[model samples]
Target: MPARPDRQSLPYRDCVGIAVFNQQGDVFIGRRKAEGDPEQSAELGAPWQMPQGGIDKGEDPLKAALRELHEETSISAVSLLAEAPEWIYYDLPDDALGIALKGKYRGQRQRWFAFAFTGKDDDIDVLNPGGGKHPAEFDAWRWEKLGRLPSLIVPFKRDAYDKVVEAFADIPRRFNLG
Candidate 1:
């Protein structure tokens, strides 16, 4: 059998993730659109995920998070609440090793941000780009309880989601929104 590639030989792509919370303390979650997914089949096992995307070459992670949020959900009425103190990473599953992310990355090293949604719910428009170069990532979206996040995303990404949940679990208390 061929020797397995070491992690160092497979660098992760730098990425950003967003957790947008509404006044009711619910967080935004989107149903990933698989229509033209290059890496996933039409029926990706996990259909739901939070807004996330790769950070541009020189873009700040926070900026990427906000941009991704708007690009994916058309919601720009958010204010930063907190940024994770450290970056966290997750490896792509074997099935995705050579097919996902254009095979340039082994997985993702992400910086997560929590933001409070200041606009009304009507601000969300997943099907239309409020103003973005990239196409939409989600076909539909809705507010969801933070605790339920991990279970909603792909298995390979669950741990990353769990870490995000832990990192921002104090949001309600810290922001006095609960």
Candidate 2:
């Protein structure tokens, strides 16, 4: 057989993910609004995911996480609980190999944050993110048991979600928020 292509040669995009946990320890998840994505295949399942987005140029990861949270869900009322010590990476599936992330990355290297939701549910306004520089990503959202995160995201991203769950698992007990 010929040599396989080296996926590691490609760079991973720097990104931030937020795990917003309610007082009861449930984390926030959002349903992806299906759109025409030339990068992804139709076979993928598990449209639900936590709030996440790219880290802009020279922007701090925590700042990016907050911005992503607000832009995607209009949620700004949160108290920083913890941050993952290591950045985790996830690779795009075969169908998304070349087109995902604008073909600039093999996958994403994400720094995740754990935040305690400090506001009421009414504070979340997914439909209209104020000012509208970025379009809405989730059509619906809900609080879910944190353990279910790995099974609720796209397959290619499951490992990262698992790591996120593991990294932030102690927050509830450590902070006695639950």
Candidate 3:
């Protein structure tokens, strides 16, 4: 039998996350498409999350965040608010270690950006994001209170989401005021 590789030996994938805040201080979240068997999919309670994706080789983190946001949500009319003070990281749960992230990463280390959404609600479209150049990551999306994000995400990702919320805690409020 082959020996399993140590989880610690695996590296985290570099990624970027985007938090698009609407005029009312709510942030955008999307329901992720279910993966694997029904039983496993059912375990992911409230599977809502902000748009995020891998940093392509040699790509700048800010640009990657914009690209991911556009690819996943088709949102392009936004102004930068702030970037997380430092990278936030999270590990996949035990059951997803060899399956999630295509078995290449232990988890993801992310640089998160906050943006103020400027366009109308009619401008947003998750079904054909990036003009269908990219695969659909979200089945549905909506604006929600920033403080509620951690509770809405999957268990393993809550900590990372917490840090993201903390990092951008004031951006949304300040943006709304100005």
Candidate 4:
């Protein structure tokens, strides 16, 4: 029998994450769909998360962030606020090593972007995201405080979320976004 490859030996997937903040300084988050297994659910942790996804080959990071934000939330009325100065990364837990991320990546190396929501609440929709061209990644959605994001995400992803929060910490006051 062949030996299994070390999890750390796998490459990290290139990805982008978007945080959309409203006038109240709250950020958009969506409740992820349950993966349909009790054990998997426990391994995945909290369901709520900001919009994020893998980046396509040869795609610009900012472009990928906008596309993913629209694809996952059906939100388009937004103005760029800030982009993280560096990529943030997180690794999947051992139990999820070969199961999550299509078993191809050990984790994600993400570029994060913060945007100000410029449209009404009605403009946001999790169902029929991207006008149904993309499958829904979230089952429900809500606005949450920026600092609360790290706690709301899965354990393996908290570090990345924390870094994102830190990177954009000055946005609200700098932009007078309340």
Candidate 5:
């Protein structure tokens, strides 16, 4: 996908992901684990993905993404952009990561925002201090090189992540030297 010349308007249309970048220029990635995801048939047991959620009516994707990051990872280092933003899209795989969704939604179309993590790695907490259910799309995680994240993600989303990585190639140098 070439760069989108038009920016997304309000109501974002669908979901967005928070690409929480750190001082090392790495982005945060999380996992999901729900009742065995029996509904999933694709690589059902493979670890995949990061913090992402649907953008609500009248709600911005960045807000939703940050909320999801906190809800899923208990971190607030993420921050959205005002003008330029990193956006990407994808189609649902025939079986989706080799796991079946057991639902009607085809797949998520996303607008991802990149953030510089000014906090420490120990600050990331998916379980949170209160201990509630993590609204996750992954079960476990580790900071990865932004360029490499796409291939590690489900094959279905590799293209989308590739687009995002391309759009934000300079992301690492943004605030990484502190």
Candidate 6:
């Protein structure tokens, strides 16, 4: 199999995105499936979230952001209605994440991008990870109201997701999309 452009490098710190809405006002959320969080998935008995992942050495943050979004959520960058300019970051707790990444930057610097879902939830393909090693990034998916999402995500990721959600609030608000 060929490697995706996002996988051209290794161990880069870049995973982030803005969860956006579909035409009907539902927010897109990709459940990280069972692979990303064994403990969380087993514990909560639920799995889903916004698509996100690390960046390649030379990839632009937006490129990386869009890449992750598709690889995880199956939503292409072309589907995005708005993408953020500046990058936002968050550190992983000592108890979470790989050891190599834990001690260094503490967290990754991420650029968040927003999309307008052009297709329905059935369009998302969590099992088809494209160039990804794991076939599951999301087990189930759906679009919720943007206002309620910050609370729906896992606690550890909530803060980071919340920051981007808050920072990008103007997208739907300004456009009055939802």
Q: Rate the local accuracy (lDDT) of all candidates.
A: 0.84, 0.85, 0.86, 0.88, 0.62, 0.63
Ranking by TM-score: 4, 3, 2, 1, 5, 6
Worst 10 residues of 2 by lDDT: 1-10
- Model 5: residues >4 Å from true position, as ranges? 1-13, 38-46, 81-87, 96-102, 128-137, 176-178
Per-residue CA lDDT of candidate 5, range 25-106, in tens?
6777765565556433345344457677777789876677777677777777555532125456665554432233333345
Candidate 4 lDDT tens digits, 81-139: 99999999998887767667877888889999999999998988898898888888889
Write model 3 residue lDDT over 1-178, tens digit each, in one string: 3354568988999999999999888999988877653312667577789999999999999999989999998899999989899999998887777667877788999999999999998878888889888888788899999899999998889999999989988975676623
Could you give the candidate ranking by lDDT, starting with the highest?
A: 4, 3, 2, 1, 6, 5
What TM-score goes with each of the models?
Answer: 0.90, 0.91, 0.93, 0.93, 0.75, 0.73
Better of 3 and 6 by lDDT: 3
The model with the greater lDDT, 3 or 4, is 4
Worst 10 residues of 6 by lDDT: 1-10
lDDT of 6 at 127: 73
Q: After superposition, how far is residue 9 of candidate 5 from its true place, in Å?
A: 24
**Model 3 lDDT vs. the true structure?**
0.86
Best by TM-score: 4
Give candidate 3's error at residue 47 in angstroms: 1.0
| lDDT of residue 59 for candidate 4 | 98
Task: Decide which is better by TM-score, 4 or 6.
Answer: 4
**Which digits, one per residue and each the tens of the lDDT, describe model 1 over residues 1-178?**
4444554678899999899988888898988878767454554477888888899999989889988888888888889999998998999877667567886788999999999999988878888766555587788888999999998887888899889999999898789876
Poorly placed runs, candidate 6 (over 4 Å): 1-12, 35-47, 97-105, 131-134
Steric clash pairs (candidate 1):
none
Each model's Cα RMSD: 2.6, 3.0, 2.3, 2.2, 7.5, 7.4
List the pairs of residues colliding in candidate 6.
Answer: 27-144, 30-49, 31-48, 31-49
